[model samples]
Target: MLEHLKKEQINPSIIEEIKKYRQKYADTADTSQTSLRYLYYGKEIWEAAVHALLCGENLLLAGSKATGKNVLAENLARAFRRPCYNLSFHINMDASSMIGNDTFRNGEVVFRPGPIYQSAVDGGFCILDEINMARNEALAVLHSVLDFRRTIHIPGYDQIPVHPATRFIATMNYGYAGTRELNEALASRFVILQMPSITQDNLTRLLLREFPGIKKQFAEQFSGLFSDIEKKCESGELTEKVLDLRGLLDALRLIQNGLSPYPALDMGLTNKTFDAYEQTLIRDIITTRISKKTESTTIFS
Candidate 1:
């Protein structure tokens, strides 16, 4: 598969990393068994990111959390063989943290570069993770960096030009509390792509690919459980407890470790959310589903 990918002009570095991770984990296979494979519903988003990388356009990924925005961003970076530096956005983030900061030198104040500055100079990919969570003041510093003439200006220091290979990918979970909306000036700097919830087929493929040896019947049941949780979330019947496919995968692994499915599911998945009532309801739903599946399995076995 690595060889085939290489023939398609895919980055050798990315192909090498994929092979390296697979070998290190001893999980190499022709197909992925992870549930996230089926969760990819935004083909446009994926393709648009790819186009941006090829065309060297900075990108912005906007969606609700757990819709695979960051995952896709990382995957695209891996696929492109571009080194990625993730700048985690937070409320207190400042221009110095992104562009550069002044520091005491041997005998005077010197400019110490930040992740954004380094990535810009290094010609690597910069993932501005959760850009919306950042203060407008912080993002205001990015305006020049993202505009047509790619350059970042630090008031007290030299003006730096970004590398031709440098591309910026910003991701955000809109309407998520604690995040402010993107201001127009900053918003105009990026090409927006909306990410959607994972589709069932993709989710199933991801599970099967991630857990190659897991029983297919169980994989189907797990996928259905995720769908059920999603439905509950849409109906406002549950919190965001069910969006982590990794949690579900771990819960199943725990069951295989001799923990009863109910308890395993609770500890691995439901317990992640703090709402007692919501947690109990999720636990009950998982337990009922597992019982039904187990009974059917027993009859067949």
Candidate 2:
């Protein structure tokens, strides 16, 4: 995969740096962190990320939904051969939850490491998903860790220096319903990269890669369907919840499993949202873009 990236014109020195880190963490690389499907990153985004890693900068992937932020984060971890800890930020996230907490074990309280703590100690790549969802107070523990000092101060335990290779990749979907603006302090700690949604050509390539047997005509229609829904969502005609690439892929999987296209797509796209009005609008979009005839040839077979 790194070789493929090299062919894309990513900096050689940056690739060498990743090679070094991958070797250092060779024994600890988590297979799960590696993506099963090839993650398609735009050339510019790929170059920016590689340089940021060389600088030992934490990454903040700021973008709209379906921009492949999480996918890229996982792909980076794999390319660098690091153990990955996927952490989801929530409204109730707290410092203790991220660092460590006192736990009763063997009749004594012991400090159990959280994802952040373990990643810091083991030189793993920690993926903080939806970084802006957690309250600022809850994210305070990340300050020192993400800064130039690269150390996290645990209240009960003394400051622990993060392994030099440990990196944090955070993602944020700004302007989404529940997302908030990232705090400037945290933003400053990261190399913020604004990600663009995958383009039509890339999306078409992704679809074909995942579903190789899909018919050309139907593939084009499916791609246009997603584009249409994305536009509707962006224009406020549909909710973002209905706009999901995973849903799209899963629906295609359902069709492969012998379900017809309409119902299969419904399972992936329409049923995700419970609102009747929203469902109707989603169905309308699906109806317009996808029809029974699109399933004439079984792509799965």
Measured with C-alpha atoms, the lDDT of residue 128 in candidate 1 is 94
Candidate 2 residue-wise lDDT, 57-159, digit = tens? 9999998877899889987887777788989999999988898899999999999999999999888999999999999988888999999889999887788
Clash-forming residue pairs, model 2 = none
Per-candidate clashes come to 19, 0
Q: Write the per-residue lDDT of candidate 1 for residues 61-170, one digit (tens) a residue.
A: 88876777777776665554455678999999999899888899899988888878987886667899998888887788898899987999988767999966677999
Q: Can you tell me which runs of candidate 1 are displaced by over 4 Å? A: 1-42, 104-110, 272-281, 292-301
For model 1, what is the error of residue 49's alpha carbon versus the real structure, in angstroms, after optimal superposition?
2.0
Model 2 is weakest, by summed lDDT over 10 consecutive residues, at 292-301
TM-score (all chains, Cα) for each model? 0.76, 0.84
Error of 1 at 231 (Å): 2.1
Candidates' lDDT values, in order? Answer: 0.71, 0.83
- lDDT, residue 45, candidate 2: 88
Candidate 1 lDDT (Cα, 0 to 1): 0.71
